[model samples]
Target chain A: MASKKDPRTPAQIKLAKQLGAAIAEARKKAGLSQDELAYRCGLHRAYMGFVEQGRYSITVATLVQVCSELDAKPSEILDEIGH
Target chain B: MASKKDPRTPAQIKLAKQLGAAIAEARKKAGLSQDELAYRCGLHRAYMGFVEQGRYSITVATLVQVCSELDAKPSEILDEIGH
Candidate 1:
């Protein structure tokens, strides 16, 4: 369960999910598995799965690495609603 | 040292610092101490110090909590460059 009264609203969750969808699409476009991307990003494979599932709340550092591994920009990941 | 090649860039770091400053300012405006904010935010006091010092990378969860403790919003914390 997430902390209630936190900054992430339903809107933010929706946005995060949208961002995760974008990341999954990008990873597919680049022909990379979740494990491959996680390795490239220097994160745990399970963490990558959580990211894809929108189960984990991420930091800017994680965001940068994931996007870098996927050859993405933060804006790019966020620009499209669902990819 | 933090993770190299991490998502946090000089720009993102700048933004975070600015955000931290905004949070500190808001806390002051609300007349709360570091300990008080930390307690209300459910974070460690030392962690709050690191956040204020811009030495720690934070998660969205943490962001939500800190901002909430300050009676602030994500946009409010970020919209002001420094205040």
Candidate 2:
């Protein structure tokens, strides 16, 4: 498991947080709770919570799963981060 | 280290390949070789090649590092995949 305090630069951390917020916003827009979304993505509810909190370094595969479940394009979520 | 054959869905794999191609294209547009870009991002050259080849799952932190070095936004790369 990756540590909560992974070795990311400040800019990277900022981007991760922004990305997390975007994901959370999208999930809300799609009218899915964290648990429901996690179930749809086949991810653990706790893991999904961590992701939304920006507490871990998220993998591209996981991102795709989450986005697919939310009926969102990965680019759309990323676009909200402005980077 | 993640395996080359990670258990990603077909859609995820396709998106990964597209993202990799976009990264490679952006790197070229910035006139940076894999070696140069990897050095800038503090990643191994072979690892960078794997990323470009979409042979492994990439982390958001790594994406940020690469995009920063390439003068790109994460959304731009994901956008090229149209998702």
* Cα RMSDs, all models: 7.4, 3.5
Candidate 2 local lDDT, A1-83, one digit each (tens): 86466676777677677778889999999999999998988889998898888877788778878888889988777766665
Q: Judged by DockQ, which candidate is best?
A: 2
lDDT tens digits by residue: candidate 1, A1-83: 86555455675576566657778899998899999999997779998887887766787457656777777765445335421
Candidate 1 accuracy as lDDT: 0.70
**CA lDDT of A57 in candidate 1?**
70
DockQ value for model 2 = 0.67
lDDT of 1 by residue, B1-83 (tens): 87656455686677567656777888899899999999987678998887887766776557656776666765445435521
Best by TM-score: 2
Error of 1 at A31 (Å): 14
